[model samples]
Every structure is written in structure tokens, then in C-alpha cells.
Target: NREPQLELLKNFQKELTNYKENLEKVEDVDSYKKDVSFPKICKTNDDKRKHLAELFEKELRDKFREHSPTKTIYTRTNQI
Candidate 1:
């Protein structure tokens, strides 16, 4: 019946609230920040885009290296 569905919904809401509270109680640290070093000369939008692209490429290369240590990775250098 609908009564069981309502009870399940209530339980789900309670669990979600508890999860949110637990997340809130966690310390706000910089542990989640990536260790990628960004350039200081990102004054223009193009520069920012290039910096982000570099970060993404670096992350992908790192992941590839982590999964397959023997594989050779070739990165193309941009003219910018």
C-alpha cells in the first residue's frame, strides 16, 4: 500500500539528513584541493583556459601513469 512507500520515503529523508549533518561536521581542510601548481600570470581568459587545460592534461597523464607504469605517454606541446 501507499503507507509502506511513505514510510520508506521518511526513512530515506532521515538518512539523507544524517548524511548531510555528518558531512557538515567534517573539518573544512584543503585536502580536497589538487596538488597541481598553477601559473601566476593567468590575467586573461585565454591564459586561464590554457592553465585549466594544462591541469586537466596533467591529471590525465598522472592517472594513465598510475594505471600503466610501463606505457609511454606522448604529450603535444601547444604553441601558446
Candidate 2:
């Protein structure tokens, strides 16, 4: 129901942020090739993206926990 919808929203947000960050880094690399000596913008972008991904994952996990703890909670079976 709402659980899946919320999850999708969270994922969308995460991907959107990543895309934005990457685009910015690409532009920076192209524009500031001499001014900014970062060796490789792609590398920096990848590192940033990794950190962002981790942060986003934690945030989404926490949100899911608060909103739908049942999503991850496993139950034991009891036979009569």
C-alpha cells in the first residue's frame, strides 16, 4: 500500500541527489580544468556519490524503520 509508495519516493530522492551532484562535478571539471587541479573530476564525483549513497541509504532505512518497521521485521513460525 503506502509502504511501497514511500519506499519508491525515498529511492527517487536518493537518485535525484546523486544525479545532481554528478552533473555539478562534471561541469566543474570541464569549466575549471586549469583553475581547479583535482586531477580527475570523475574520481572526485565517484567518491562524493559513494558518500551520498551511504547517507541516503541510512536516511531511507531510518525512514522505513519509523514508518514501516514491519517491512524488515521477520517472524518466527509456531506450529500447533
Tens-place lDDT digits, model 1, residues 1-80: 45654565565556555644444444531232256444778665455445555554565555544444333442222222
Model 1 alpha-carbon miss at residue 8, Å: 42
Alpha-carbon lDDT, every model = 0.49, 0.55
On TM-score, the leading prediction is 1
**Global lDDT of model 2:** 0.55
**How much is 57 displaced in model 2, in angstroms?**
1.5
Structure candidate 1, residue pairs in collision: none
How many clashing pairs does model 2 include?
0
lDDT for position 56 in model 2: 56
Predicted structure with the largest lDDT when compared to the true one: 2
